[model samples]
Target: DEMAQIREFIEIAGEYGLAYEYINCALERHPYKISGKAAIKLLEVGLLMGFKSGRENDKRFDRR
Candidate 1:
């Protein structure tokens, strides 16, 4: 499910995937030139998505 969500997200928002891959490469090679805000925003959105999904899963588990 997580993979599916990630795949859907990548398909729906290709820009974010591009940004992530670019940043991943850039950080490994040269870590100083990346825009901090853009990286932070990306991480924030990712964390939010994970949190929301975890909460939903928790609810489902609790309902059992």
Candidate 2:
């Protein structure tokens, strides 16, 4: 079931021309830590693929 959902999410991201690497990375690193709402927001903003670590990535997502 979880795998199905992940596939579905990848398809949805593909529809938006979003890459799957970040999602796959997040899944690999923190499979059960992601929240549905956060995922949706990330997708909505086209930031799902921009997910990264460290200070630079953090600054990129920070709101002014």
Candidate 3:
């Protein structure tokens, strides 16, 4: 299910063109320091793209 969501996100990103390219560049540039603001931005993007947080009634994917 998680993999399917990821694939869907990728497809959405592809449809958005340069948006995903910027995201990929950001990710690549911050491979080791993906915390704080960068992390929040990524999460915001994923949520905006309709990717589930997998936190609802599913502790498996919860942060804590």
Candidate 4:
């Protein structure tokens, strides 16, 4: 079932440091060998951390 979902091409995002934070969090938490909601939380923490970092850097970046 999961494989079936990935066949549709999954996408992820984070703040300015997405790749670094995301991979580090996944590796630190051993997100592999797991599935579903718990896995989502592990990844969510990383993204939120990255978002926080970016937010701290520039509080008004909405001009875009």
TM-score, candidate 4, is 0.28
Rank order (by TM-score, best first): 3, 1, 4, 2
For candidate 2, lDDT tens digit of each residue in 1-64?
A: 6555567666765533223444545576774677899778766655544543344546766444
By TM-score, the best candidate is 3
TM-scores for all candidates: the values are 0.32, 0.27, 0.33, 0.28
| Location of the lowest summed lDDT over 10 successive residues in candidate 3 | 50-59
lDDT of each: 0.53, 0.54, 0.53, 0.47
**Which residues of candidate 3, in runs, are more than 4 Å off?**
1-31, 52-64
**Candidate 1 segments whose C-alpha is farther than 4 A from its true place:** 1-9, 12-26, 29-32, 51-64
Which tens-of-lDDT digit does each residue in 7-53 have in candidate 1? 56567876554444444445656645658897788668755544222
Give the least accurate 10-residue stretch of model 2, judged by summed lDDT.
15-24
Candidate 4 local Cα displacement, residue 60, angstroms: 20
Clashes (N, CA, C under 3 Å) per candidate: 0, 0, 0, 0
lDDT: the better of candidates 1 and 4:
1
Cα lDDT tens digits, model 4, 1-64, are: 4333333333432233554344445555675676678668855864565433244445453233
